[model samples]
Target: MKTILPFFPLNLVAFPGQELNLHVFEPRYKELVRDCVANESNFAIPSYVKNKIEYGTEMKLVNIAKEYSDGRFDIETKAINVLHVLNMQNPYKEKLYAAGDVEILTNVDNGDIILKEALFESLTELYKLVEIQKVPLNTDFRVFDIAHQIGLSKDAEYDLLQLREERQRQRFLLDHLKVILPQLRDIQKSKELIKMNGHFRHYDPLEF
Candidate 1:
């Protein structure tokens, strides 16, 4: 099914089940948020990359955290689905913000059980290396659900959003882990060395 959605172009990529809190101040976006809230509507956040808007995610407004006297708003939203841009309109129908007619993409979950377990372990190790503790994810959590929390770049996350199969995304994640683990370990080792530099280590006097 196709639909015309209120569009919010952002530099960040949002994944399904991901919660995003935003500060809405721009006049156009302020109107956008106000309208969505009043109508109980959903919006699309397209990833703006390299001067072009590409794939995006659909998010439902969860709540308005606060509303300022100047009409600015702070909102909390959760991504509901992914979308592929079919076409777009600027200042859609004389509204302040842009609008896009997008096709909702299919989200498939066909990951290999073994590969999924490995991905989970790798993510855990990565978080540990960075010294950040993540909450226990639900049993139904898919890899895509945590891709952003696991430290994928904006570009990488956007790329991942385009994948239609779970196994393909899993493979991409596995490869990313393989490349990132060593780099993270190297960083951790450097931090350790830096901390130890000032410590007193007994050294043997060389025969001069």
Candidate 2:
């Protein structure tokens, strides 16, 4: 469905189900936050990449964490869904911040079981290689839950957001990890070799 929402253009991509805590300081966005809280409405975080706003994630205010004396406040939010911008309105009809008409993208989790399993294996290896102590997998684990830590570039993340199917996203991420694992292994080997540079080593003599 298509609807209009207050647009907060950010440099980072907001993944589905991601939690964000924002410090509302700018007058325009401050106004937006107040409006959202008052109306109990959700807002859009349009990814501002390449000096343009296109796709983003929809979010709802969880609470106003703190209110500073200078009209600035900290707010927590959870991403609800993905959004594709139809049009943008700066000032949003007299408000300082921008707003947009967006088409909400429903996430499809019809991923192949095998694909998920494979993806999970790759994810596990990736976590091990990166030394991430905690794996955030829940009952229904997904790529969005760990996208931020998997070495994806901003552009790659944007592309991931554009995909609606869970399986497609899984494949994309799996391929990404596959490409990275070899490089990581190579780097690890290089590190190991480098560490041996100034150390004494024992050699086994072969008997003829």
Candidate 3:
């Protein structure tokens, strides 16, 4: 069934069964949050491509984590469904709230525990490299979630959001990591070479 829904365009992709914490400071989105809170309806979190793609995920407001005196909100939301936008009209043009018709997507079936485990192992190794390099990251999730964070590209993330089934999503994550790991290995090797040569930042100008 197609329904008109409130739209929030963001730079990131949200996946079903995953939690997204948002800081809502913009006035239009504050109103959008108010509307969702009042009507108990889900909001669409679509990616803002250069030309605006019509695909997005629907998220349910889980809890209002915090509220500031300035009427800003820190809220937690969970992706509940995927929606394909049929049409969009910028109703609140000043603050950028869009109204659109979206069709909910059905779930796909594709799960393999072995694949998931292998993906997790690969992700853990990647995270270890980051940690050893002292890269500033506040990664607190398990290997699977971490893989989802680092493995997915902007477009791939949008595609993952459109996937309805948990199993298919896991498989997609696995496939993503399979392709990403080799590249990560090359990056790690390059970093190690730089470190052995007195780090990239401390390299002597005359060495070139």
Q: TM-score: which candidate is best?
A: 2
Q: By TM-score, highest first, what's the ranking?
A: 2, 1, 3
**How does each model score on TM-score?**
0.86, 0.92, 0.71
Model 1 lDDT-worst window of ten: 132-141
Question: Which residue pairs of candidate 2 clash?
Answer: none
lDDT of 1 by residue, 1-208 (tens): 6888999999988888899999999999999998998889999999886567879999999999999999999999999999988888889998999998999998787888888888878877887898886655554568777787766777788888899889999899999999989999999999998999979988899998
lDDT for model 1, please.
0.88
List the candidates ranked by lDDT, beginning with the highest.
Answer: 2, 1, 3
lDDT of 3 by residue, 1-208 (tens): 7887898888776666678899999988998898889999889987775457678788899999998999899999997777888888887454357778889887664456676666557666767755655532343332224435575677777666666665676677777777877888899899878778854466457764
Question: Which pairs clash in the backbone of model 1?
Answer: none
Runs of candidate 3 exceeding 4 Å displacement: 92-96, 132-147, 164-171, 190-208
Error of 3 at 109 (Å): 3.9
Candidate 3 lands at a TM-score of 0.71
Which wins on TM-score, candidate 1 or candidate 2?
A: 2
Whole-model lDDT per candidate: 0.88, 0.89, 0.73
List, residue by residue over 92-151, the lDDT tens digit for candidate 2. 898999997999988898878898888878777777777778875543688788788788
lDDT of 2: 0.89
In Å, residue 70's CA in model 2 sits off its true spot by: 1.6
